[model samples]
Structures are given as C-alpha cells and as structure tokens.
Target: MTQQHLEPPVAAGLPTPVPGRAAKPSMRELILQAAAVLFYAQGIRAVSADKIITKVGITKVTFYRHFPGKDDLVVAYLERRAQSERDAIEGARRSSPGDPAGALRLIAEGIGVESCAPGFRGCPFINAAAEYADAGHPVREVVASHRRWFKATIEQILHEIGVADVSGVADQLVILRDGAMVGGHLGHRGDPQVVARSLVNAGRAVIEYSQAPD
Candidate 1:
C-alpha cells in the first residue's frame, strides 16, 4: 500500500492510459519504472529527480507533471518493486499449474542470481528504508502488504493440500526465503536453489505424513 500504490488513480474511477497515454515514456508508470531501476540499483538518496529525468531523457517539468516531488517517486519505486514480486509469483503459478512444490521451487531459484538490480536488487523495501529511515513512509505499506500476501498465499496453498501444521510450515518457508535472499546478496557460500529444493522436499514429506493419519 505504498503511497504510490495507495494514491488511488489520477482520476478516482478512471483507468491509466498506459500505452494510450503520454508519449516516449508512455505514461506515469513508465516514468515510475525507470526511477525504480535507478533508485534500487543505486541508493535512493544517491539518485535525484534530475538524475531520473536525465536517465529517462525527460525534462524535470515533465517529471513534476506526473509526480509532485521526489517523495512521490520513492513511493512509486516501492509499488513497482511489489508489482514485480507479484509478477514472479504469478508466473510461477502459470508455469507450475496446481503443483505447489514446483511453484515454491521456482521462487527459490529466482531469489539467487548475480548482479545487483532487477533480478538481484536485494530487497527493494530494505533498500528504501536505508535511504529514508521513515517507518511511517507510504512505501513501507507496499513492502508490508506484499510480504504478508506472499506468506498468506503459501499458507493457503498448504491448507488446500491438507498439510498439517500449515502455519508453522509457512512461517518456516518465509524465514528461509528472506534468509536466502540476504545470503545471496552477501555472497554467502550457500546455494538457495539447493536449499530451496530441500525445503520443498520437507514439505512433501509433511504432506505424506499428514495423509497417513487418515
């Protein structure tokens, strides 16, 4: 629910033009996405509205036309990151099709990679906090809601599959997931793909055990 995401549309009930609106950058969304890459790749504080305009090849006035100020830009970055995470999860679902284990495995593999932004930007939420240090910022909600939804989705899938101790399992998965991302960022010797697969195996065993009871 970052301010950017929560800000409601430019018009209450109206839809964004996307391809239908604006030119070059296309629309407000394109500007927001370009800014996210800059801010996440380099600390938010290190990037300025002027820099964003330069990178996007747009004038500061046009930037202002979309967002009132830099704070607004930061919120947009957070929302963009959350949307990326959501897309990853959705892609897993489409690729796996009812196979929760496969979906979980795909997520684990995604967390590990080289480079620093986009694929390996660490965590956008954590990066934003380092820049702003404001718990009350609109961006925090985007981070909070997305993370919460991920865990809840895991728990729901487990419940659907009749896994006993569903909540405990979901909590463990969340910890391992967040931990693996940090480990990858720090260059830890651990392979998240290996570790993630192991986690899925454990979940499979739990499913088998739960079924044995009945």
Candidate 2:
C-alpha cells in the first residue's frame, strides 16, 4: 500500500498546526477531504456518514451543515475527483500545444504513474460505477458525465491527428486506458512502466488503424 494509505485517514495531508500560525482548513473542506480519502480507500457504500463524522471529529450537526445527506457527500467526493482529472488532461494539452500525440502520451504517462503509486485500486470512476448500479442514480450520473467528457476529449484529439471515423477509435483508446489502469493495479502485466508503455502503444495503434486507407 502507498504511504498515504498506511497513515491515519484523517491525518493524510493535514498540516501540523503551529501555535497561532498555520491557517486551518474550513470545516467543509476538512469533512470533504476526509470523506474523499475514505471513499477512495474503502468502497463508497462501505464508508458511512457516521464514519466520516467520527474521522473528522465533528458532530452530526456540523457534518449535516456541510452535507445534507450521504448522497450529497458522495456526489461531492466524485465531483472533486472529476475536477482533478479534467485539470490533469487540460494540463497535458497545454503542455503539448498543437501536438495531439504528445498530449496523448502525457496522458498515458500520468495514468501509468498513478498505477505505480502504492495502494492503487484501478479507476475511481469504474469503482464508483460498480457500487452504483442504478442508471438514474446521482453517483452514476456523475460517472457518466465525466466519461462523456473524457471520450469527447479523446475524439477531439484523434480528429486533430487526421484520423477519420474517430468515434470507434476513441472508444478503443478509452478501453485500452481502462485495461492499462487495471493491469497496472493488478501488477500481473510485468513491470509497471511496461504497462504504461503498452497503453501508449495501444493508443497509437488504434489511431493509426483508423487513419489507414480502406
């Protein structure tokens, strides 16, 4: 497991408050952060609101003030994760302006790095989707929304790369990424870096295949 997993959940990234010095996190952020850690480590359904309240050292009143219900907290947790992912992908694009392939490579590398991290447990979206089987559920909506954005992003990149019929290719690339994440977490696919390279290569192959003459 990663060092963060080994540490106390509530203390994962909390700063040591100095005497009259460090700025304290707002009660909302503190509660949300605690819930994010637990929800990611343990399944969302497995971690309860009371557990989050206890971990944050807050009363039911305070917890409810920030999040009206467990679903509220779960949605917030997923939205936070989704924002982080969006930022990462945008950053990759910015880092490789006008170069779709380079941005794609950076994206693969980022996923690879996450897989190699200790306590990696595959994709957060996938995990959440598994627990939330209802199509109309809020959590599933969040997952579906994020996935739509991701697939559209890939489709845009492929279009820029001169690949025709990118719809199927984009789907293939996303599936390849999903497999790579799981493979990296399972550690049964040889070295972690190899798994990452395979993702990049597989992505490129899909793009190239779509670009080929009929």
Candidate 3:
C-alpha cells in the first residue's frame, strides 16, 4: 500500500485582517441605538424587541443576554437620553456662569434647535409617559426622575434671578416647554426660525410675567 501524503496549509486561502480598523459597536450599544431610533420615531408600544433584534442583527438570546427584557432595553435607552439631556442642560448652565437669564436663554435656544431639527419628535419623556400610563411603571419612574431634575434646575435658575416664588415659575416654565415641544411636533408647520423664536419669546414672557409686581 502506498503511503498517504498531506499537503501543508497555505496562507493564501485566508483573508488578511486589516490593522487599526475601527471597532464595531458592542452588541449592547447596537441594540440601544436601534431601539432609540425606533422608539422615538414610532410609539414605544408600536416597537418590539424582535424588530430591534433584527435591526441590530442580533439573536433573541444575545439580545436578552444584554437586556433581560424589552422593558430593560427601553429603560436603558431612556436613561441614555436622560443623561444626554442633563449634559446639555448642565453645559448650558456652565456656559453663562453667574448669569441665570443667559443660561436659560441658551437652554431655550438648544430646545428650539432640537425642535427644528430634521426628524424632530416631541419630548421623549413625554412620549414615553403617554405610552406607559401607569405612574408606578419603571418607565414612568425614569420620566418622573428626569422631570424632577429639570424642574429643580429651572428653579435654581429662577432663584438666581431673584424670583421669590421659584416653584410656581419653574412649573410654568416646564409647562411652556412642554407646550412648545408638542406644538413644534404637531402644529407648528411654519418656518423653523419662527418656531424657535416663538419658544424663546414664550419662555421669556413667562419669566417676565412672573417677576412683574402683582
């Protein structure tokens, strides 16, 4: 019987890996990115984990490994959004140190820019709250937490501006912002400039009225 001979493996068959190639997003980040887009564009209830998994090119097991349930993913997405908003507001505050009105104007401008952006959706927290009606739900908790922080921030600004009743002013400011956001999304079909200027003017008006002597 003839002895059998084995050929050596060739390097040509293997594809060369590129060095310093940009790293792909982690499975978790990919999932969240997809969820954020879908959740914001469509209503939260309209989106499903399966849709997110498919968009992220992940399997159910892998998806669940990162997020045990859809709600967990939703919470994470909102948390990321919450942090981003906090950063923006904080940055605005920091931009005009010792100038409360300037800081508020910067914040209002930021909101106007966001409202006028392409594919602008109404406030994510408000949208999420609308979908999850139960105040006890985790989603609602996150919404509540972010809102409380926002109101407190506004109150701090008002206090700095010598507004004695910061609570009422803060509440009014929050309501005005909410209205502007909703109007920008639903009713304000005019120029983006107009929409943005309206928001800024409305916010300023509220503050001025509150500070006016009764």
Global lDDT of each candidate? 0.65, 0.81, 0.80
TM-score: which candidate is best?
Answer: 2
Candidate 2: residue 137 Cα off by (Å) = 0.3
Q: Over the stretch 1-214, how does candidate 3's per-residue lDDT look in tens digits?
A: 0001211222333345458753445567667778888888887999999999898787899999999998998898788788878878999899999999999888887777667666677898998999998999999999999999999999999999998889998998899889877876784655656766777788788888887899
Model 2 is weakest, by summed lDDT over 10 consecutive residues, at: 1-10
List where candidate 2 sits over 4 angstroms from the true fold. 1-23, 187-190
Q: lDDT tens digits, residues 1-214, model 1?
A: 1122222223322454568664333457657766766776677888988888887788878889989998887876676667767777778768987787677667655654321223455566766666665567776666677778888888877776667777777877777666655654565554545655665565566556655755
Candidate 2 TM-score, true structure as reference? 0.88
Where does candidate 3 stray beyond 4 Å? 1-23
Better of 1 and 2 by TM-score: 2
Per-model TM-score on C-alpha atoms: 0.72, 0.88, 0.86
Show pairs that collide, candidate 3. none
Displacement of the residue 18 alpha carbon in candidate 1, Å: 14
Q: Pick out the ten consecutive residues of candidate 3 with the lowest summed lDDT.
A: 1-10
User: Which residue pairs of candidate 1 clash?
Assistant: 1-142
